[model samples]
Target: MLKPVAAIAALAMIAACGGSGADESTPPEVTAAPAATPAPVAASTPAPAPVAVAPGEPSPEFASLPAPYNAANYAIGKRTFKLCQSCHLTAEGAGNLVGPNLHGLFGREVGSLPGFAYSDALTNADFIWEPHHLDEWLTNPRAYLPGNRMSFAGVRKPADRDALIAYLMLETGYTSAEGDAPNE
Candidate 1:
């Protein structure tokens, strides 16, 4: 049973990437994994969606984030970040996963994290990570730089990309001052 479930999930991922020769006009639906059973709740009360920080009250870790990035956007970005959690980690001192730990990604040089084995395409590139660069990269990593190891099809929506970038900036310790530096 477990094997069958895994197989179905794998197939779903492939189909989501347009691997099944599905129609191109309609967007594909991708499920990372089978859903787990929810715990029982009282009939009168429904489970509320998880919120990382309450509206109007940002978490201490993200309180310094500037305007246009509020708790609401943070929550959306947190949810969207689920797509990236399997490959990357945002916490400081957390070692690399399939991708590098992204604690200070905003101002860091691309592919320059100390321990991870970056692709030659990235390692040979000369550039720093800024919000705009990250936005383009997340829009389509493969198109942005070929021969990289990441296999994500890329986030297709601009709004999602914005939210994800904002989330990354907040989580990865981006400061307004970093935005002032010219990308090299």
Candidate 2:
């Protein structure tokens, strides 16, 4: 009986030394908790930094677009761009489909990309592809330039057009500040 009581007391002491011995009346001390360790990042993979973008401007990459333009905007813009994807390829070095490959379209001349067949209406048009011009073209392609080869009716909603253009600007590496003068 004496040996069994001593054994029980030793086990009780061990239980108290462990964390599980706290009584119901005593609250756990938060300071006693171990600090959280952050997940380690792989050295080879760097996160994208946000790029500054002004209102009515385009970003070079979707991940780099600043606060007002977030991943949500990219998602919406990406979905909107599906309307144009059937005819265009926004990726770099991608071949032209039914329409021209739209890589680097923002600053290029309307019909200047080589190899792709452009309609006479587009070829004759004298305009560089800036945001405003793109907006107009998207609103009504054939109306913007009669006899253009694009058969699909243009995007009617201004917001939808804006989103699609934003997506295009991202995929094509267009920077809002590309041609801007230095503040200095």
Top candidate on TM-score is: 1
What residue pairs clash in candidate 1, if any at all?
none
lDDT of 2 by residue, 32-127 (tens): 678789999878977676455554444445545432332325555777888888889988899999999999897898999999989999999998
lDDT of 1 by residue, 130-163 (tens): 8777777888999999999999999887666666
Give the lowest summed-lDDT range of ten residues in model 1: 63-72
Q: By lDDT, who's the top model here?
A: 1
Measured over all alpha carbons after superposition, the RMSD of each candidate to the real structure, in angstroms, is 22.1, 11.0
Cand. 2 Cα-lDDT: 0.73
What is candidate 1's local distance difference test score? 0.77
Clashes of each: 0, 0
Cα shift from native, residue 33, model 2 (Å): 39
Q: Which clashing pairs does model 2 show?
A: none
